[model samples]
Each structure stands twice: as C-alpha cells, then as structure tokens.
Target: MHFVTGGSFHGKAKWVQEHYSASRVAEGWFNGYEDASWETRDFTTSLVVLEGLEQLVKKVVEENVIGGRAALRGKLKLWLDWEASEPDRRLVLIGTDIGKGIVPLEKENRLWRDVTGWFYQDVVMAAERADVIWYGLPQALK
Candidate 1:
C-alpha cells in the first residue's frame, strides 16, 4: 500500500501514473465501497488510485455522515485488507493536505479538517510507503 499526499494539484497523480503505470485509476469520494457488491472485483494486475480522499472526508464528516468513524474506518480497513491480498497489484492513495494552512471558520469545516487529518494519520501509519508531493517533487515519509 502506498499513500501519496500533497497540496491540491501538486502532480501526485502524475507521479503515480509515471511510476506505477496503472491500468485504471479510481477516484475517491469512497462513495459506495461498503455496498454489497464491494467484493465483486479483484484489484490484482491493476493499480487503483484513490484520489481526492479529503473530498471523501469532507463528505463523510461534514455531509450526511456515513454511519460514523467506526463504520467508515471499518470499510477502509476492509478495502486495505483486500488490497493487501494482492501483492502484484498496487493501491496509490492521493489526499490533499487539509491539515495545513489556516484552520477553517465554520464548525463543519473544522470537523472535516480534523477528521481528514486524523484519518490520514491512520492511513500513513498503516501504509508501507508514504509520500508527500510538493511542486511535483515527492518526498517519502516512511
């Protein structure tokens, strides 16, 4: 598992595509992976790029709310476990560094920031490799 994060439009996706050469890239929002058909596809032989995770965090935390953190984390873990099963495949995750910059004014925005930061911490901990892109340059964290 690889976690690639950075400020928005910092070429994280370009780096992933250049380095990994994926068959397909999946956008994140993580909208419906918990549904009954989540297990239908095997990620082997393909690289899955989960881009815009902070957007998902915003939706998950600020919007209608999806079950709660436990439920959301459970689904994430489920997906990670599935990805782990296939070494030949790769999962490249790209999230904007929402934790940086000035904090938001609204409570909902603040909540989104907090949740996204915390959730990204979790992902970095679990990831085998973590990279942050700045001005199209990638720096490895772990």
Candidate 2:
C-alpha cells in the first residue's frame, strides 16, 4: 500500500497518474469526491488509485458509523488486506491535507478534521510507501 497526501489542487492526482498509468488505465481510478462508498468498490485491477479520502472520512465521521479509532482502523484493514491479497496489485491512496491553516469554527468541521488527521496517520503507518506533494513535486515521507 502507498499513501500520498498534500493540499487540495496540488497535483497529487496527476503525479499518481504519471507514476502508475503505464500499467493501468483510467478504469482503475476511483474518486471518493464523487462517491465515498468504499465497500461498494470492486478491486479487480492491478493498480487502484483511491483519491479524495478526506471526503470519505468526513462522510463516515458524519454518519456516525465510526464508533472509535478502532472502528476506523477496521475500515482501513479491509483495504490493506486487499493489497496484500495480490503480489502484483498496488493500492495508492491519495488524501488532501486538511489539518493545516486556521482551525474550523464549527464543531462538525473540527470533528472531521480531527478524524481525517487520525485516518491519515493510520494510512501512513500501514503504507509501505508514503509521500507528500508540494507544487506538483512529491517528497517521500516513508
């Protein structure tokens, strides 16, 4: 598993595309911005790019489906298991960094930010590789 994170519109998607498009088509691209349903996705491709994970975190947190950090980790375990199921398969996760800048005034926004931060930490910990994109340049974090 690979994890990439950066501010919104910082070219994380473009970098991932260039890095993996040689072996994978656009069909493997999954945008959580459009649909945040992780359970409904079918992992049949060798390369799977899952972007907009912050949105998915927000959705799950807002829905109150996550009872605690353990619950969230369970969700991540599913994806990790999928990646480990195949030696040739690669799972690239892209999340926008939303914890920077001014803190949210609303409680809901604050909760989302906190949950997303925790989720990102979990991903980075489990990821075999991790990077942060800045101005379209990727800097390895792990």
| Candidate 1 segments whose C-alpha is farther than 4 A from its true place | 23-45, 63-67
lDDT to native, each model: 0.70, 0.86
TM-score of each: 0.79, 0.92
Which digits, one per residue and each the tens of the lDDT, describe model 1 over residues 2-72?
99899887988788777775433343222122332322345444456676777766666754555545545
Going through the candidates in the order shown, the clash numbers are 0, 0
> What are the per-residue Cα lDDT tens digits for candidate 2 across 42-129?
7888888888989888887877845745667887898889888988989899999999999999998998999889989999999999
Ten-residue region with minimum lDDT total, candidate 2: 20-29
List of clashing residue pairs for candidate 1: none
lDDT score at residue 83, model 2, on the 0-100 scale:
81
lDDT of 2 at 71: 65
